[model samples]
Target chain A: MENSAIIQINQLIKRFPMGKGEFTALKGINLDFGTGEFAGLIGPSGSGKTTLLNIIGSLDMPTEGEAVVLGKPISKLSSKESAKLRKESLGFIFQSYNLLQVHTVFENVEFPLLLLDYTTAERKKMVMDALEWVGLTDKVKSKPPQLSGGECQRVAIARAMVKKPSLVLADEPTANLDAANSHNILQTMLNLNRELKTTFIFATHDEKVIGYLKRKIFLKDGLVDHEEWINQ
Target chain B: MKIAFKLAFRNLIGAGLRTWLNVIVLSFSFVVIIWMKGILVGWDHQAKNDMEQWEIGKGQFWHNQYDPYDGFTITDSHAPIPNEFKPEIEKGEMVPMLFAQGTIYPQGRMQPAMIKGIPANQTLLKIPTHKLDSVTDVIPAIIGEVMARSSHLEKGSRVVLRWRDSKGTFDAAEIEIVDIFSTTVPTIDVAQVWINLETMQEKLLLPEQATLFSFANAEENRPAVGDFRLKTKKELTAEIDAMIKTKSKGQSVFYFILLLLAMLAIFDTQILSIFRRQKEIGTYVALGYTRQQVVTLFTVEGAMHAVLAAALAAVYGIPFFIWQSKVGFTIPMDTSEFGMAIAPTMYPIYSVGLILSTTLIVLLTTSVVSYWPARRIAKMNPTEALRGKIQ
Candidate 1:
């Protein structure tokens, strides 16, 4: 993972203001995520998995040390540079199936391509292909509110995969679904990762998602407790 | 920016009732503001036209001592009609007018009146001076409806008219009301009577003398007449212009309140929408929009309300404005008392500039109003916003 790394983090630390005092969320973290790796940060509530994922997605900056993502130092990236990195290369899926409720499944999926300046026809094809990959082609016209939990997650997945981004950061992607829906969403993400060679990094402690990941980094008390490689 | 507009348009449409509710209120403002301004424009246009035909007649030459505001000057404002204007008056292109302070006793009720004299043969003014040509034993006079109503004199009614001559010799005579004319110009009407210029000159004992000369050839340049000042049509209508300007200023406060309400509706909607759509804003940022871009998107979305409102205004306002133009807006009250050239019913003039300026004003104002709240998004933290947290 280190040699083929698409993300390299060394001695990373993050802090939050806790009413005049500070709470350190990550303590001297060192990690590397190679291309095409289906990995996750496993932790309990408040274990800082989401914070770590957020930093890697360039949504936040590390308070100390270096986080180089796709060769751009996340700690030093300007707001615009970070936005450009996210727009061109990164995709995000959220726990609540953070699909734009008013948008149709197709529109939700096409959102990323709209930012990439794809032609309308190209966007249409790309969105359709991504929906097909998620087995949500039949639900293209349905809005997120009209879909089942599993269907909404798949739409979220399609949105994440539409641009074929180099990285997909999903935060507790299955936290709101039932067991069957959760497994279905994981299987879809797993298949997408394998076929597109896109790296998947999720922040979750769910067993269903943990079972599908080939690599897992366990966090306890804002520290990496251990890491294990499964099905390698 | 184009993509922002597109997205904003989609979002506004997607919001359904919320968007339309705001748009409808704004559209109402659009119609009303345009309509009110149009009425003022129409009134100005009509007043100028009426003054041109009934009173000013291209322009007037006023006696240097003649101030319409001062009654003391009326006794001395009279000057003998200049020799140079006599040819034009003979050509029926100019009319000499004389004014005198007089008293009329109709049905035993005394009323102070203005005695205005215009040549019976002149075609420059719309007054019924020709009716004065066939004067019988008594002098024939034309009075406006307001004067007739106030003086209680009707056509065929005989009244006593008394006035002082230039020599300060007071004289009295019997006069018959020949006609009671209806006109929009109060300057030519209210408590005033029109009689033959020759008859007025004879009664005032000022032969070949007049207070002013009204010329029909508005374009012809005139040489300086002895002690008389040339008043152009613009200067002549200055009173009406000033009145309309004052009315417009008074109405501006109403317009501001109207715009403020409409803008407040839009501004409130934008601020509320920005707060309610925190997750959506976060989603937008996550999907590659910088916070500033999201702000642009919200601002565009809000400003598009004006565009939508304009279209909505056109949908209903066009027919209303057209109907208003056809039927004219009627003042329920008599305009004769206003002492200005105001008609009972006034048509509105809607110019291209007015419509464009109004739309642009509403748009720019709405954009500014929308932008004020949208600036908050630039400072938002996408992570908290993603969770739909307020702070």
Candidate 2:
């Protein structure tokens, strides 16, 4: 109920229908995320960490109780409404970078902005500004395939932040990168969070990802086993 | 929508091989369908045009009764075409007299032939009088030069016509040869002869009747006939040329079926091309394109290929049509049995409507056929689709 808490979850549950019965992914879970926090949702594979992130991301619905972001009940939003909300209020960074490989980095960054009816000049300016923030301003004309794994991840970050979304969900954003590239990406994301006051939510199993987050939630068998917050 | 198109365009470029393959398959299918439609419709038009040009004005009549008892009875009989029926042959309406028979003898040689009685100046059906290259002004009682030469008939030489009379008796008439002509259309030149209708009708005592009548009237409504069935110029040819048309249509129908099968084969390839690009479609969806947008993208691609293929077909088709027009297309048809010109030229007459509609149909069929599969690709969930599990 705190003013800083931008995301609220109350007894949220998610279950997948297997052969006959149900397989629960997220057992009754309660969590709250404040504004401008670098949080990690960490667990081993199939630990329901990704499912929990997806439910919060409004990409999937919770089976029981409420999952709210920006005070909007995400599970109840219509597909279009959810899409609009995701476009307006959230940015996504996927493990594979998910940059449209056919497009240039600038075009990719300008993609989310195109969904809104922004002026051409405004879209250009915002894209360039976000690309600069990721230190990829010179690589705007480069395609994803032309860039290194680290640079592609940076382009993904630039695309996510170009719209200035309230929350950014990065699902294994550094999974495809090398150890040095992973550190660089994590550092870039942390720096952007500090400079832009953008909240970062990460779903990852990497130790490097956990090491960088101020707050960590470890999910085991769909239950939140550990929760910690560090401010420094 | 623009973003979707842009994305689709970009994706098409990225997937070059798959896109072109689909285009080629679709274009090939379209060309086959269009080509079949063109040939059939063209042949029909050519036949109709030739019939009209021969001044077969338009309609034909047949006797319904068993036999004529007397002139008075003939003037008032219960025939399908009553004897009292006298159709007005106006300026535009050309009522050329036609008396047809199977056998005509020249000296020692006996040959089966089709003799058409027409006006001296009236154009012969076999002679391509409309040709810009023709040197003669009026076609003079057109006949096969081969027959004329073999018979050693000079100009103005008399030839005897032998045929069965109404009472089934043998009748003979002598007519002077006016002219002789050679044509690639063997159906006319090989077994056909042309003479003045008035001369032949009087020579044969043909009840002063015309077996076929053609009237060029723009009237939307035709006047009622008491007993004789009134027909348009087109309808007249239908009656006189019905047997020829029926045979031609049958052959074309067979050709059409074969061509349609070929088109379907190409269409099957297009479908396969679409199936093969399922992953590419998943990539499209993951990029946030809508279903309709995706459909339009592939549809445009299909249309592009159609245009290319249609152009290619036309390149080949036009020359083929011209070559056939000059040399003629013959199938050794026998017109002796029916008493008509047997060596009809298979001239290619292009129908604009036929070509346009057929091309459009090809495009529609290919696009519609490509839709469901393309839609399946467009509507797939990125979460599952990007997983790339073969199903």
Candidate 3:
């Protein structure tokens, strides 16, 4: 990966309200991700990994310090500006597969493109192409309820990648999948990362997900403990 | 807005039975409110038309002393027909009616009745007064169905009529019922009888004198004459208008209740949807929807139920309303018993304005109810919502 940073963080702290007190989920966290980097925030539950991912994704704001994605300070962005940023340049994958249950696989994949101003033909082509990347082209007509856990995850991945966003934030993406399904999903994502040169940041403690990461940042009690790099 | 609509439509359709239940309830409100309002409009139109055709004509010129509700006023309400109306009366554009109170004994049963004398050949009113000229040995009289039923008098039935003339001399005679007419106007039908004008004048010893003159039209600029009150059609029908206005207010209460029930269903569904679909809401936000946009999506989803309800109402209500306009709705009891100008069967008339306005009202009400609960979405934390956590 190039040395250009797409995401920058400096002394970021996040506190959440907890009846009569505040719980600090992240404390003085410093991190940076570059273009096309396959990175994971590796930590156990309550380590604030998901909280850090949420901040980077512009879904949450920092209590102190700064987090900037695509050169825009997330803490200072208005709700509308933050939404526009996410719409134009970000994608998300969740552990529970957050695929719209009422929609067909193809419609779910086409949702992000619909938010943009793509024409009907362009949207159709993009959705079909994204479905093919996850090998779910044949199951495009199926609903989420009809799909297996792994298939649902594949659909979610296709939906996230349909717009070809600059960054993808995945929070324990493979937690609900079996071993084989986890590996298959990870391989597909890794291939997309290489082919599309898209930056991917993951918050996960799962070994299957950690195995696919090129760089791992270990977090403990809302602080980074250490970091590791793998040579593929 | 377009994307929101498309998503809302998909969400509503995908919601399956829950969506349909709310829609069905809302549709019932649409049909029933329109139907009830239509009936009142129909009744108002019919009552005015019947009064104009049968009793009031276009207007009336009554003697200044005439008080229709007071029976004692009949003694002094008579005045010689004005000479100014002579031309219209000769042209058959006006009819003079003379009124007197009398008692009738039909099969030894005593009943009070109003004696009305209308021109035998006049065509201005639809009273069938020409039947009065066919009498031979007895005076010819026409009574309304209600008067006939109550007095046990029918066409061709003879009854003893007792009255006093202008000379204060009591008179008794036999009268033959030549016709029994049916009319929706209670004032024209209940406890009233019609006879030849000349016969009534001659019997009452008051020639060339009448209580009221029914005209084909109310002349706006006509000079006021002494000892007469010129009542326009509107003025003559003011009581009916006041009655209908009062009735409409009562009907509005029913409309409010119907709307409340439908809105409650929509409100309850919206609240439940926000609670159950928190993750979907978060997914929308994560997919780049602002929390405001998420709230709008839910509101639109709730309001779309009204659109669906309108369609469903048309499916069933169109046929039912059309059939009702044709066959009409029958009252279980006698309309005359109500002492109003009501027909035994009433045909409903629905205007496009009424339908469109009713639809707009229902649509707006449902939108408000939906928006009330959907505002909760704007306060939800996207991070917690993404985990499907209750906020």
Q: Write the per-residue lDDT of candidate 1 for residues A133-222, one digit (tens) a residue.
A: 889889888888889988988888889889999999999999999999999889888888888899999999999899998999999988
Candidate 3, CAPRI quality class derived from DockQ? high
| Candidate 1 off by > 4 Å | none
TM-score, candidate number 2 = 0.76
Candidate 1 CA-lDDT value: 0.91
lDDT (C-alpha) at residue A6 in model 3: 94
The candidates, ranked best first by lDDT, are: 3, 1, 2
Clashes of 2: 11
Better model by DockQ, 1 or 3?
A: 3
- Complex DockQ, candidate 1: 0.77
- Chain B TM-score per candidate, please: 0.98, 0.60, 0.96
Candidate 2 structure quality by residue, lDDT tens digits, A13-39: 899999999999889989999889899
lDDT tens readout by residue for model 1, B1-391: 9889878887888889989999999999999999999999999999999999888889989999999999999999988888888899999888889999999988788889999988888888888778888757899889999888888788899999989998999899998988889999988888798889888999898998999988888874665598678989999999889999999999999999999998888989988888889999999988899999999999999999999999999999999999999999999998887988999999999999999999999999999999999999999989988999875
Calculate DockQ per candidate and list them.
0.77, 0.29, 0.85
